[model samples]
Target: MAFYDDGSFHQATGVSRETLDKLRAYAALLEKWQRSINLVSSATLPELWRRHFADSAQLAPLIGTETSTLRCVDLGSGAGFPGLVLAIMGIGQWTLIDSDRRKLTFLQEAARITRTSVTLLPARLEQVTGLTADIVTARACASLETLLGYATPLLEPSGKALFLKGRDAAREIDEARKTWNFEVRRIPSQTDPEASIVEIRNVSST
Candidate 1:
């Protein structure tokens, strides 16, 4: 589709032609609704494929398709990139958490338009109380240490935190380790090799 460019996403997410069609339909809806809400950057619309779709689709590698349905939450899911995408990727239950009511409104509308099954939490990330999920995903939200403060409390003892990060990810992980006792995995990011997906887990008091 003209809106998408990343070929790796189709492969990585195991999205067949039909699923891609659904995603395209969702993108179209998002693009239309984003006009009044600012769900995503205007500059990103042209390169939606490589920039948005693929960036979010990269999570499939860490959590494979055909796996049983599991619940996950996206903290500060500003525009519902990864959380909404993850829902379409077959997560049984998904939650999009953000403080801005307007963004969550757009996310809720996007879910309605995309028919994505997800819950919306309109509250500050730090105040929302919930169970640790199978996986917790956040993107472009905060630094590793700050993110740890927000995400760690939402993760189960064995649950993993999949955070999308850029070049400074490794250093951030190093900094976060000073207070968080968790195993970290850095996987190559499809959007930018210099970027990484930091999977954080084992968040227990040392």
Candidate 2:
């Protein structure tokens, strides 16, 4: 309810009432299920709107209205942050990849409830095969270099990546630059100004 209104979430993603309602339902479900399963950081639950939902939704702009039609993959989809957010934003296709079946179950249910089209894959990102996407995203997935290793093989040429990272972003980028040649920019995060987003494209290995 009040959550959808906070965190620059609606502003970042331009969420419609239909989608916003679904995300609201998702929040409720997350709170309910989280009591049993470790979906999100418990300490972050009190501020779930700004901490989780809004943080996830802020990446919607990177999807761009044009890219919304492209196939996308969300690796290590723990709590379906930007991945599920992207689904609500009307991405043509989305696959939530994770090693945990339980999380996949939640993702699938979230997709169904939200009426957002999504595919759930219960497997390690490195082992998933025979698929490629126009965009690959991961929030709290892994280090940038390791993330590239997991995401690059599945990305189509001209594909882009949106990763969420904290204060150590520059160090992560430096490590990523050791083996990857891509244009990476850090955008100020709407949730926390001290935080930033790592946007990577023109992916190449050094």
Candidate 3:
């Protein structure tokens, strides 16, 4: 099933009209910014709703019902994928981190246009400090081992890390386990059959 527009996006995700409007504005801004800043892949522009919006929106349900009080931090949030999208969905208080100034600029503008409030951190993941979150998210940011290293210090005890991974998820998990010990639950991706959402917790260095 392909999501080509807002109606289809709403049907697929069941977001409210207000949220849909925010997403529409966000999409327009993304398209405009993509022309100069390379916010997303040019090939995926035609399927923006499916490739980006819906894909990011799918993370909402997995976060459970109590989102208002949760703090979510997105590592390497290049174009704000699940982070900004979740903020617009009213999922949680969000902090998005990215090293690129230009991408951070785009995210700031997108959040302004979408009327979604988020904290933007312009720094590499390792340089980020003095912050913690109930949830940490990343998409196409780095290898599982690297992401785990980035997330471990930022995550509160009992917090969870949700990573969007493609077909190499199992292998990545295996490799990650070699350096760290964590419990992982693999949730099937709503947007792509071959992809998966890897939910991890109880992180400790081995």
Candidate 4:
């Protein structure tokens, strides 16, 4: 359960040696940045491989095999958990959005250190426009309703939204259904049993 090193991470995710090296550099940067920026919760730092790396990597399998051509928008990408990690894993073309200038700075450096190309947007999710994506992703970003509001406008007609939700996923889904109509598939989280990866598509207003 404790993935304290890159070996454990590769064992769990099956990343190639080259990808694993990049992740190592990425993790090193995260640790160094956390000293001043509070990139991630300090408690979870000890388990960075499993808590952030693997947690983000798990989405790759669910994304299917067309990653190279897909455009993904990540909302509120604080420390770029699912977004930067996914990009490093070669999942898709990623655009990470966040309002904090400091965090955006960190993402810029992280992307460079990991050799992962990603667009860093220094703006609120609601302020973004004129950009559409094949997929939208967020983790600990917002409630299900608000996330849908942010995702719907940017999502291509055939696109899907992948949200990592905590224990209240079912409750949030029920509440979201009050104002939105969408087909959802709930996949259990590989990292946390109490969490779930919510995949939504064919969305429309109620």
Candidate 5:
């Protein structure tokens, strides 16, 4: 949301001074670690605040305020785009899951520096079980059909799944309907016109 300029994001999100500090620290960590590992695309690093931070922070508002103490699970939380950012914004009980230990290592340091509490799961999504959450988030992780497969098992009956997708999102939803029965709402992205957030609820096998 016009995060290209400094302070624009803070204004838009209305985050506290403490939360802003944590986000700044997170940006620093991402820049530092990127040289050694591919946390995010090299091109996007120059626009980290707008492309990554803002993109991730946008999910906070979509969540219902009634859903307090939200249990959030971020599937394939690479560089913790929305997951780690959500943790800094104090969303709820956070769990960042990824198969890459290296990425998990980076997330651990980021969480430590930001002074955010998070449960790190360093394993494939299928290996994790008995984990139910209220809000599930996945960004640039997988095809919509595949994401539903992973999320369906971990979501509570009334939970919501917020997935960040590009222009092809509508097609993905159409494809997913072939196997899954659910209610979906599309929210236009504040950053990119071609991108959107797909919110799915009441998911079930067809």
Candidate 6:
């Protein structure tokens, strides 16, 4: 989608007024924290609504609406792109995991300011275990192969993983298949045409 303002987000997504208010709060917080820390790419700040908010918001439609609640775990939730955005949208029960404490601190404050609830895991992917969820997500985190390794243990039996990847998505999927076997599909991204959302299910080591 083309870069636009908050009105574009509201018109496209049709999110509630409360959600929009929270998103506005999130945008302000993200911009404030970015000066002191790298919350998002500096270049994307000017178009925050289109670049970040809308990019993350697009994933909501892909998430099945059949269920009233979905337990979601976001691995390597740096500055909470899809994770924090989804939480603000009230997608479901959220667990955001990241290795950086400072980022987590920023997320904590953002959640407080937006009044969004999330379970934050301030730990590395390898350090976490016995965590399962209906939906597992990651964005700009790691290679597809490595992401599968991190997401594998957190998936519920019927869960699926939605990974946002850039132009190298196809190459990463091909490489990931060497050590893993699963049903995977590529969903074209609305924000960046060259990028894609890789959805994986029934994952297992080959």
lDDT of 2: 0.82
Which of candidates 1 and 6 is the stronger one according to TM-score? Answer: 6
Give the CA lDDT, 0 to 100, for residue 165 in model 1.
94
Pairs of residues clashing in candidate 1: 4-49, 5-49
TM-score of each: 0.90, 0.92, 0.97, 0.97, 0.97, 0.97
- Which has the better TM-score: candidate 2, or candidate 4? 4
Q: Which residue pairs in candidate 3 collide? A: none
Model 3 lDDT tens row, 133-201: 999999999999999999999999979999999999999999999999999999998788999999999
Q: Provide backbone clash counts, one per model.
A: 2, 0, 0, 0, 0, 0
Candidate 5 stretches greater than 4 Å from native: 66-68
lDDT tens string, model 4, 1-206? 54667898888788889999999998999999999998899999988988898888889998876679799999999999899999988998999999999999999998988889999999989889988999999999999999999999999999999999999999999999999999999999988989999999989999
Q: Where is the poorest 10-residue window by lDDT in model 4?
A: 1-10
lDDT of 6 by residue, 1-206 (tens): 36488888898888899999999998998999999999889999988997788888888988855534899998998888898898888787899999999999999999999998999998989889878899999999999999989989889889999999999999999999999999998999888889899999999999
What is the TM-score of candidate 1? 0.90
Report the Cα lDDT for residue 139, model 6.
92
* Model 5: per-residue Cα lDDT over 155-182, one tens digit each: 9998999999999999999999999999
* Candidate 5 least-lDDT 10 residues: 61-70
lDDT per residue for candidate 1 within 1-206, as digits (tens), equals 23245355576556777667767777787788778878788998888877788888778768666544677888899878788887876654788889999888877777776677788988887797855688888899988888888877787776888999999997898888787788888898877768999988787554
Model 2 misplacement above 4 A: 1-13
Q: lDDT of candidate 4? A: 0.92
lDDT of 1: 0.79
Better by TM-score, candidate 6 or 3: 3
